[model samples]
Target: MLQTQSNKSSFFVKRPILFVIVVEVLLLIIVTVGGAIATIKELDYIAAIWVSFTPIALILVIYLTWKRKWGSLGFQSLSTITKQNWLYHLPLILVLITISLKGFEDLSVSKVIQFVSFTLLVGFVEETVYRGLILKAMLNVGVKAAVITSSLLFAVTHALNMISGQDLANTVVQIVYSLLIGVVLALLMVRGSNIYPLILFHFLHNLIQFLGPEATGVTYFDVIALVILVIYSIVLIKSLNKKTIKGSIAA
Candidate 1:
């Protein structure tokens, strides 16, 4: 187990981009297969299968952290949101506003618990992989490269939606929105922020996003989110400099 862990961990440290590609491809496959399986399986059975994924992800994180001897993945604690970096949270606020506008479906206790658990799982896993692992890996190239590459890869992750059921046009827009919003999340790591709050952000946003089964997400929020993120990204890009690459490598 130790040797296997070392070998796997070295693969990520030695070839970060390749590791990222493999991880993304695996994610795509898992989601695709899992989605397909859900249709053919009972709800409780499918839920059990999906919930099992969280522990597997956790084990991977623990193994890698141990093998690499990483002191942190920016997830140990939450940092206070100060005036300096407070603006970076606007996208999350926008998500709240958008969800409010679109509103939510009636919820039972079981459904609310399900949404919380599901979104929390997503938030923890995705943030650790993208912002924590990928961002730290890419920093060796350059700060700009790290930010753009991590964010772009993360954004492209949403493209898998098209394969499942979404239309092409909507998928394209999702990719764009995800790309821009991804940059903000990546920048939080660069700014020496903790991953816990970022995970919480994901939790809240995705809870509304994946609310009830009948939820239609194509509200006016999409257009407004796109515009705001585009302009916000431009300003952030301008702000990147030698000072921006502050976080230590995940290794």
Candidate 2:
């Protein structure tokens, strides 16, 4: 019986994409069900969101243990940050700064702490699942495929927000920009070869959205940032391909 279980585990290890998809589906179910329960029971929604990630974290640990592929999940040292990398990331940094300038005046200490904790958990789980596991799995096909597929999956997953009572039109816009951000993030991960920076950036980005001034509508700055993000993503993708070629030649 142990041997049979081992064989089944090995099968999943050999087919990582299938394993990742299964895990993603399970996570989706957890999020949906947990949100529903929270709504019905009048539970603290923030706490519920945090709790929903517990199973995902557990699954990540199990997969890492089973495959012994922690390094592949961006647990290793980051690649060198070149001038190009800084340039590619500049727009995002600017956006973050602008958002931070919006300030945290009205928030209490406890609320700030809670929001930080929630954003950190979100950053860790989402990046691990999308950029780490899903991207790693899709890399078996090719880098381009991995980037596009993982980004699409990441964007699509945000649809869950609508179920949690988000405005439909706003959610649709979010899904679109999220797809672009997802692509940029995937490319950044490939170029940097580390997930920690992405996690930090993701957390800050989310926190900004939570605390920033109320949006009457999409602003000109938002459109500019989106354009910059797309341009940067393309450049990063090319950089990744060049690095791949160099590695191939070295090998």
Candidate 3:
């Protein structure tokens, strides 16, 4: 039997735009305050991330328990990935390849454990919220609007780094790069309707970047990567728009 959502008349269900805004604000406060506390305590980055996102994840878990709409939010198994949408999968693969270029700087047991735990938590929390919850809610607006709005908000969330003392220039670049990646991930969620692969890839990508030698500063490769992602995002938006429009007409 199909388990329908119990809260059909709830405020969030009726006001998805407002729901998105509230969620964004809640995440920003939770994450930013956690990061700030970690900094003040001189804690490790791992602790900072765990402190910040773990609560958010648990809250979503509670919501899922109440609603039981896991599949609707793209939390299905990996087998649900649409093998037919091969092109939609390439951008994330390419980004993963780019991230893997960063060679490992540590391989100790504790470090590896931290790497796995940290990356998994980061990937799961972020992918679940941004691509799963936010994107799904924004879809009530329209495909293009959902993609653009969620992606832009995802990028904006990175501004929290500036509060933690990251340099202005690097933070700006990160925001832009995150926005492009957001677009790719959002498109994948909509077309493929599966998020397991996204969570896995995000885990690996972050792990690889952490493994690699720390950059002295942003390099030419960063610029190249950003430009490539921008072009790919544009092509995807155009292609997706055309297909969705055609489908709407046929319906």
Alpha-carbon local distance difference test for all models: 0.67, 0.73, 0.77
Candidate with best TM-score: 3
lDDT per residue, candidate 3, 1-251, as tens digits?
A: 12245545555557889989999889889987998899999989889889898898899889977877577677777665556665577776777676566556867889888888999988998888888878877676677777888889988887667876888899989898898889988876776667788788789878887877886667766777787788777777666655653332221
lDDT of 2 by residue, 168-207 (tens): 8778877878898899888876665567778888999988
At residue 11, candidate 1 shows an lDDT of: 63
Each prediction's total of clashing residue pairs, residues at least 3 apart in sequence or on different chains, is 0, 0, 0
Candidate 1 — which residues are off by over 4 angstroms? 1-11, 32-52, 68-71, 80-83, 212-217, 246-251
Comparison by TM-score, 1 against 2, better one: 2
Model 1 per-residue lDDT tens digits across residues 137-219: 67656667778888888887767677768777778888887887798778766765467767888878788776634535555
Q: What lDDT is obtained when candidate 2 is compared to the true structure?
A: 0.73
What candidate 3 gets wrong by more than 4 Å, as runs, is 1-8, 241-251
- C-alpha RMSD values across all candidates: 4.6, 4.9, 3.1
Model 2: CA > 4 A from native: 1-13, 79-88, 101-105, 245-251
Q: Rank the candidates by lDDT, best first.
A: 3, 2, 1
